[model samples]
Target: MRRGFKTEAKTLALELRAEIGLDAYSPFDPYAFAAEYGIAVVQLSDLDGPARHHFLKADGSALSGALIPNGTGVVILENDAQPLTRRRTTMCHELAHVVLEHEFGVSLSDERKCGLSGDQEAEADWLSGEVLIPSDGAFRLARANATDEQAADAYDVSLAIARWRMNHSGARKVMQRARAKWA
Candidate 1:
């Protein structure tokens, strides 16, 4: 991700969290967040075959999710066959696109048919990570020497995501510094 874009995403994540009344350590509810912003969340299963196929890779691995522009609002389509954790991440990602007001196109050749530029995808991915596992929450867990499992449990995220966030969000560094101070 570009440094400037990541900074913007982080700022947006914090602002969204505050707008939704989320505390530093609380698990973010992407559905509620979408609802607050007047976006609709729909399951891929609810769509017809053609529409479903549009969001799936030929290998059958889900595309995770997609954001479709509606009449003034947007609809988020999530692959429900995946695990809940995956669905949560996908929803957050799609919602990130909406929150950032990324453009969409009418043609399939468009990136995921959503006109998301490469930079937009990176920003959304980073922002979604922040939304699912806020830095403050990661730090709180790290301060307690929490394991990846603990971070997953605390944030209701997948273990892999927890590990990434704990390692990459500067939480581990903060924890080490706190430990040094105590020592």
Candidate 2:
């Protein structure tokens, strides 16, 4: 990411949430967000083939999701066989790539390798986290002293993702520092 990328992502996430009639405090729906952007979302089960089987497997090695750029739009294919929470994260991840306007390079190779540069991928991952649980939402959760599982349930995200957002977003640390200062 660049100097201003994180700030930009935070603003975009909150704005997009508002555009969908959701406040920064509400859970985000990637499917609705994708429809708003006119991006298509398809499930891997909707496909039929050996590749689908490979990608749909519940194993840890299975593909999470993929983004394909169309002429002026994009489509997201997610591994629906996974848990719903995992699917949601994957959808947002693919949407993040589109939202970031990342120039594609194959996206998926013959060996199922992602073509995005590491930086681009990292940027997308961070941006997707913002989209799923905006900084404002995370901050509110932290202020309430919400647990990771509570945040996950509230945001409809996985426990790991919720914990990552809560920990890395600095919301908890900020609140802790504020409490200590006032105490």
Candidate 3:
């Protein structure tokens, strides 16, 4: 990702936070936020191929605003059938896609084994992490030397997400140091 574009994406996220009453370090429920913004929430067990793989999509190729077709103004989220936290993260990822207007055809990475490849996906994941587990919460938990499960419980997020947040927020070194000291 280009530095300019990355900054732009962060700016967009900040703008969205202000627009939707989310602060710099406040946790926001993606599902409820979507509902407030008129984004539709869908949970179907078995969807078709494209629907299942895409996770979410707009009416056509335009990925700037809500995914609602016509005048519905609804954002659609495909459930992964995981826990509520996972579902919320997925929805937040989709919302990031919309806000970022990620390029539809560009490939972020060139790994055949990896399914979701793109700079867009990475950005979306970062955005979702910021939204769900804000910096303050993550920093507090990290400073407390919280376990993975404890952090997850505190943040109301999944273990995987908690770990990722820790890693992304530059807590990996802190965690390593704590583990070594305890060991």
Candidate 4:
């Protein structure tokens, strides 16, 4: 997690708030915000559809969303009946991709390439996390959890995303030790 990304994410969140007439740092709703921004929204009935794989691609590889060039529209998979928290986080992640303008005329295949070494993706993920789980709130949740799953459920996000946030928040060693002891 870079300082710059955090700064930029907060900045963007504020800008979005003003643009949408939301109070500073109000709860973010991707669907509403996307609509307000003049970006077309496409809903997929396939989010809950059984696929032969682990991810559900909305535009590119996996269940990720990409903003079309010039911010024309945002394509997202509709995760019907999924936990609200999970849906919110995923939407936020897609929004991050859009806000960062990652879809600037690039082919979908070229954009779907995910290798762990990519800082851009990491930055986007970080931005998504920041926007969804503000730092103070995240820290408070992390402190009360007995397990990663508990934390994930509390935050309405995936365990991997929760774990990553924990690691970045300096709670990794404690959380890991707790898990090891309990496991």
Candidate 5:
């Protein structure tokens, strides 16, 4: 994570949520967001041939998702074979690329690779985290002393994502300080 990327992501997340008319604690509907943004979300299985192989792999090194440029809009291809939560994360990541208006390379592989530049990937990942689990939502859960399981349920996200958000979003520290003060 860069020095100010997290802050930028947080701001962007909040603005996007507001633009989409979502509450701070509501589960973000990536599909709805994509629809509003004029992006199409397609499943990997729905594709044929090489495109399918590019996203779904027999090995675990499969791509989670990719954002492809259309004529004027964007198309998001997700590996739907994965769990729903994973798919959601992938969608958000691709959506982050769209929202950030990242320039596409000439080849699909350039934009599709799992290993993008560190800063780009980090920014997208951080923004996707904020999109899925807003800072305010994390803070609310943390203040309630919510477990990772609780956060996952509340946010409709994977346990790993919930854990990361709770720990890294400044929520856990705030909650801990509040608890200490009360004690």
Candidate 6:
């Protein structure tokens, strides 16, 4: 990711949240956001045969979601068989790619073009995380002494994702530092 990319992503995520009549602390709805952007979100259950089995019921499926671009607009294919939290994260990730307008070649059937590799993929991942749980929201949860499960429930995200954001997002560390300073 670029140096200022995270900062930009945070701003954009907040703005997007506000656009959907939500605050930074509120849970993000990727489906609604996709609708707002005029992007079609289709579930993998909509597919039949091999495609459905590959993404939904396959063992160790590397694919979580995909963004398919067409001549007029793009559509997001979400693996609905995954858990609710996972489905949300995947939707946000696919939407992030569309929002970033990253260029890509034709997508392969396998895991070859699973969101286009390298920087674009990284950017989409980071932006998706931010959209799912803003850093500011993480900090607030930390300050409130919220546990990973609490954060997950509050944000409608997975506990793993909540823990990752609380730890990796520097929210807990910042809260600890603040407590030390006040103490």
Q: lDDT score of model 2?
A: 0.79
After TM-score superposition, the amount by which residue 165's alpha carbon in candidate 3 deviates from its true location, in angstroms, is 0.8
Cα lDDT tens digits, model 1, 36-154, are: 88888888899899977877777776666666778887787777887788778777777777777766421222112234657777677678889989887888888889999999988
lDDT of 1: 0.76
Candidate 2, superposed: residue stretches over 4 Å from native: 50-61, 105-115
* Residue 20 shift from truth in candidate 3, angstroms: 4.5
lDDT of 4: 0.56
Going through the candidates in the order shown, the clash numbers are 0, 0, 4, 1, 0, 0
**Model 4 lDDT tens row, 1-183:** 565777677667656655667643245567787787666654444434464133454554343333334435555543433545656665676666677766432212222222233666676677777665555445566556636676666555667766766667555566567779999
TM per candidate: 0.84, 0.87, 0.63, 0.57, 0.87, 0.88
lDDT of 5 by residue, 128-159 (tens): 88999999999999988899999999989899
* Tens digit per residue, CA lDDT, model 2, 1-183: 677888888998888788789987778898898899898888877887875766543654556677766777777877777788878887777777787788642233211125576777778778888888899999999999999999999999889999999998889999999999999
Best first by lDDT, ranked = 5, 2, 6, 1, 3, 4
Off-target runs (Cα >4 Å) in candidate 5 are 58-61, 105-113
After superposition, candidate 4 runs with Cα above 4 Å error: 1-3, 10-28, 46-63, 70-87, 105-119, 171-183
| RMSD to truth, every model | 3.7, 3.5, 7.4, 7.4, 3.3, 3.2
CA lDDT, every prediction? Answer: 0.76, 0.79, 0.59, 0.56, 0.80, 0.79
Query: Which lDDT tens digits does candidate 6 get at residues 43-128?
Result: 87788878766654345553567777767788777767668888888777777778888763323233213437788877877888
Q: Which of the two candidates, 3 or 6, achieves a greater TM-score against the reference?
A: 6
lDDT of 4 at 63: 37
Q: Candidate 1: where is the Cα deviation over 4 Å?
A: 1-5, 105-117
